[model samples]
Target: MKKINLNSEIEELNPEELDHIEQALLSRAQTISKLAYAPYSNFNVGAAVLLENGEVLQSSNQENVSYPVGTCAERILLGYAGANYPNSTPVMLAIVAQRAGEETWASVSPCGMCRQAINETENRYQRPITILILCANGNVLRVKGISALLPLKFDDLNS
Candidate 1:
């Protein structure tokens, strides 16, 4: 057996430091969070995917009576992208979450399932998707690719 080490780089940024596209994607995610249907958890989440063709798609968390049936913002965005823009490749993704009755939002990481979905997106496109995680308190985190988030990713059964 061989020992392997994996590492990732995460960049902390201020809101004002974001570039034009980054700002747009992050702002859209925040804006979409307000539309989430999270009556049970009250944790509204939003995600925005920027395609290589310059199209930005936004989605919000959709909840169901049975919590297990609910879907996350990341999956919703990915589903929409797969159905609507099958040929287009995603270049970046921005995510934000806000709790009910909270004035400030917090940076929310993608769920394990969503992380796998993001990794699959990168595999499908054969390109990296820049991730911009934004917090309402003005903290921002950037990951170069999903690999940075999920280093030991699951590709297939026959590894």
Candidate 2:
């Protein structure tokens, strides 16, 4: 029998430790979270991406009456980036969420589908994308790439 282990590292950082670009990304994510269409779950989420071309793009979750038809902020942002700046690689991604009518920010991670989407993006660009997650207690969680979050990711079948 063989045994295998999988590990992931998440760096907990004080919000003040973030550099200007990271701070701006998180701030934009926080601000855009308020615009999410989450009438069903009331859990609004926002995502911001930094492209190698020096463009920052942001998106908020869009919910539909049928839950499965809804789109996550991360996927939406990735789609826009791929469509608008296909040649530019995404260097970083910041995600933040809050409950509707709540003043406190909630700690949230990307869903499985979104993680896969991020992994595909990384593979497409042939580069890693740093992820910043806003914690509930005003801290930030840093992850180097989508592989950390989705270790056993699905690869391109065409490859």
Candidate 3:
């Protein structure tokens, strides 16, 4: 048996150090959360993905009445990116999630489907997607790449 050590990096930003672009991403995510259609769960989620060509996408969770048909914020943003900007590779992704009537933010992890989609995006682009997740109090959790969040990943390119 082999041991695979995995580590993650997060830069806790002091308000003054928040970059303009990242700040905007976080802002968009927060705003998008308001538009989430989460009547059943009442948990709103938002996502912002930055492209290399200076395009940043902001999307909110869209809930379905049937429950199972609804998609997560990450998948929504990724789908939008794939449809509108097929050639652009995602450079960064920022996520913000909140519960109903809650004034605080909670860290949202990408689901398995989103992980596969992210892996496909990374493989297609041949690059990494930096992630900057935030809590309402302004604590930032940053990950350098999508692969960092998804280990033991299986893909055609790697096979």
Candidate 4:
């Protein structure tokens, strides 16, 4: 089997030098954090995606009384993007999280489920999506594509 080292493919980008599409998503992600319904976790998360057509979409995590029902900000944004714009593919996504009532940013790693969801989209579209996660002190944890995070993933070839 051919092994793909995905991180090698992840392009490290300076926040200041991000492309216009990336900037749009980052701006929207920050704003969407305010709309997060994360009363349970108290850790609000926001995610934004830039579509091929240049439309920016964002969403915040929605918590539920039954914890199992809660959805992550990344999946929420992607789901909506898929539903609203069925024909379009997401080109990039940026994620950020904040403590309740705090403006300080924290790292937003993709949950296992979020990773799987992202994998599906990437596989479906056959396109690598750039993911940016804000880190402390103005640094960014950037992953160029979903493939690296979930290496040896199950795909059509496996079946």
Candidate 5:
């Protein structure tokens, strides 16, 4: 048997390293976290998607009485982007979360479903989606693509 190695780099965000657009995307995610409708869990999550065309869209988690009916911020943002800007490729994604009564915001990683959704988008658009996770520690985690987050991802049976 051959050995396989999977490696991913998670870097702390350096203010000087980020460009204007990256900074703005992170800020949008932080701002949207305040508006999440999470009455049940009180864990508000926010996400921002930056399109290849330079358009940035933000969304907050929407909770529902039926837990399964609710959606995550990442899915909401991606769904909206796919619906409205079908032709545009997603350039980057940023995520942040905060508790209902908490002043500190934490970096929330994408759920398994969201990771697959992101992988689908990347394969469909033929572009890598950079991900920025804003942490409560006042640092950000930077990842280049979905593969970094979800190694050995599920590909179709045809593959």
Candidate 6:
């Protein structure tokens, strides 16, 4: 038997190092996070997507009494983009999160379902979407594409 390893690169950067557009995206995500309806978990999450046509779409997580019925910020934003701007391709995505009563931001990554949704979005567009994750220490983690997060993702065509 042969052992194979999968690896992905993550670039750690300070907030100031990002370009203006990226900064704006992150800022929007942060702002939208405050609007999350997470009474159950108290874990507010926000996501912003930059479309090829220069449109930025943002969303926050919505939770319900039944946990499984809730939708994540990333999926919500992706769904909105797909429904409203079908022709535009999402070029970048920025995600941020924090606790309900916390004064400082927290580092978080997309859940498995959200990762699959992102991977599907990238596959549908046939383009890579740069992901920027806001870390707890005020730094940002950058990933080039969903492949970096879900290398062996499911492909309907292959199925």
lDDT of 2 by residue, 1-159 (tens): 998999998899998899999999999998899899999999999999999999999999999999899999999999999999999999999999999988999999999999999999998999989999999999999999988899888987875
What TM-score, over all chains together, does every model reach?
0.94, 0.97, 0.89, 0.87, 0.93, 0.98
Question: Best candidate, lDDT-wise?
Answer: 6
Off by over 4 Å in 1: 1-4
lDDT of 4 by residue, 31-123 (tens): 898899988889988999989887888899999989999999999888899899978899889998888977688777898889889998998
**What is candidate 3's lDDT per residue for 1-159, written digit by digit as tens?**
998897766567755577898889888988998999999899999999999888988999999989889999999899889889988889989888999998888767788888888888888888988788786676887777776778777787656
Q: What CA root-mean-square deviation does each model show from the true structure?
A: 1.5, 1.0, 1.9, 2.8, 1.4, 0.8
lDDT of 3 at 133: 79
Which candidate ranks first by TM-score, i.e. highest?
A: 6
Q: What digit string (tens of lDDT, one per residue) describes model 5 on residues 17-74? A: 7888888998999899899999999999989999988899999999999999999999
**34: Cα error in model 5, Å:** 1.1
TM-score of 3: 0.89
Query: Where's the lowest-lDDT run of ten residues in candidate 4?
Result: 4-13
Better of 3 and 4 by TM-score: 3
Ranking by lDDT: 6, 2, 1, 5, 3, 4
Q: What is the lDDT of candidate 5?
A: 0.90
Q: What ranges in model 2 sit over 4 Å off?
A: none
Better of 1 and 5 by lDDT: 1
**lDDT per residue as tens, model 6, 29-118:** 999999999999999999999999999999999998998999999999999999999999999999999999999999999999999999
- Which of the predicted structures, 2 or 3, would earn the higher lDDT when compared with the native? 2
Off by over 4 Å in 3: none
- What's the CA RMSD of model 2 in angstroms? 1.0
What local distance difference test score does each model get?
0.92, 0.95, 0.85, 0.84, 0.90, 0.96
